[model samples]
Target: MELNTSLDVVPVVSIALMGILLFVLGANVTRHRAIRGATGNQMPTDPTDRMFIAQRAHGNAAEYVPTLIVLIVVCALLSDGWWVQALAVVAAASRYVHALGMLTSKTLAAHGPLRDLGAMGTYASGIALGVTAIAAFA
Candidate 1:
């Protein structure tokens, strides 16, 4: 009954975190798309413009989801411990910040580092899972 992270459901921590991000970001994208389609306004004019922040958020969500799933699955498969779980949480949180930064008209999305963070999250997690899986059973 005590909390253990080694081989028993450590992935749940990140699963819950990712789940929250998926739903929240998915809803935001849907809203942005609907607004654009209905109004044809194109929201933000540039990275530093109004409504541009949300658009950037929408973009980040679209970019990182698939790889995140792969990473999560790999970690779950390996029964990854706290580090993997922590990475998953960080990935989710980073994505959220990237998206929210998009909504502020201040260009906190950076058009550079934030995107790189997301890519690293996807690639690192995926690579960790892939390498471990191959090394274990191949």
Candidate 2:
């Protein structure tokens, strides 16, 4: 069966790309941990710099991507407009920026400019998207 033309593709495309990114980040963490001899029966709680950054980047994406996907899908299903597409773009960009920031930071918890901006963008976009979905359905 052919894909529905009216079904928005933005959310699918955006989330797919984010999934790839998250996979790459996870791979990087695994590779670094293995190279550094940090892997064993349990994951390293205090990993090396590269491992820590990659893990955080991947973990952060894991935390947010599902929610973003849900919001985008709901918005696309319930509404007929550009808002869903726009939010998908915002969510994707936010995750990329966040990963970049996470990888470049000296400390995962420290406020790097890109990290802060990306986090704020993610939160704002997510909130707006959730609200939009509610408005669309309600």
Candidate 3:
């Protein structure tokens, strides 16, 4: 079988960047937990406000990154069109927005407009990619 090089750049770069972001967020949470004197192997039971924010941000990324990766790969395989690349770009950007919103907000549950928009954008990109995949594979 032949290999396709088209549609590879954006998704690959996005995946790498997401990995870096996850690592940084994870480290942030870990360091904060240590600062709170919870250096044991187990997670902190009572996280501070900042700890909560970091944990939630990392947790959100852990939950969504895999799905984004899968969808991006599927989109790349199905087509290397502008829509596919746009979805990849939007997915990456939304994650940053969400992370920033989580970090800057008063609480994890009370994410600001950036967080809301990021979540919506993420879902929209995933949905668009799924539809595109279906249309291409069908």
RMSD of 3: 2.8
Off by over 4 Å in 1: 1-9, 30-37, 43-45, 80-82, 108-127
What are the TM-scores, per candidate, against the unseen true structure? 0.60, 0.85, 0.86
Q: In terms of TM-score, which candidate is strongest? A: 3
- Listed per model in order, the count of residue pairs whose N, CA or C atoms clash below 3 Å is 4, 0, 0
Candidate 3 lDDT, tens digit per residue, 7-58?
5777889878777888889999878777878454345334337777788889
**Which stretches of model 2 miss by more than 4 angstroms?**
1-5, 38-48
Better of 1 and 3 by lDDT: 3
Query: What clash pairs does model 1 have?
Result: 53-102, 53-103, 54-102, 54-103
Best by lDDT: 3
Pick by lDDT: 1 or 2, better one: 2
The digit string of per-residue lDDT tens for model 1 on 1-138 reads: 222234435455556666677677657656766766876666556766444555556555666655665666665556445566665666666665555445543555355555555556555665665664455344
True lDDT of residue 81, candidate 2: 75
Candidates 2 and 3 compared: the better one by TM-score is 3
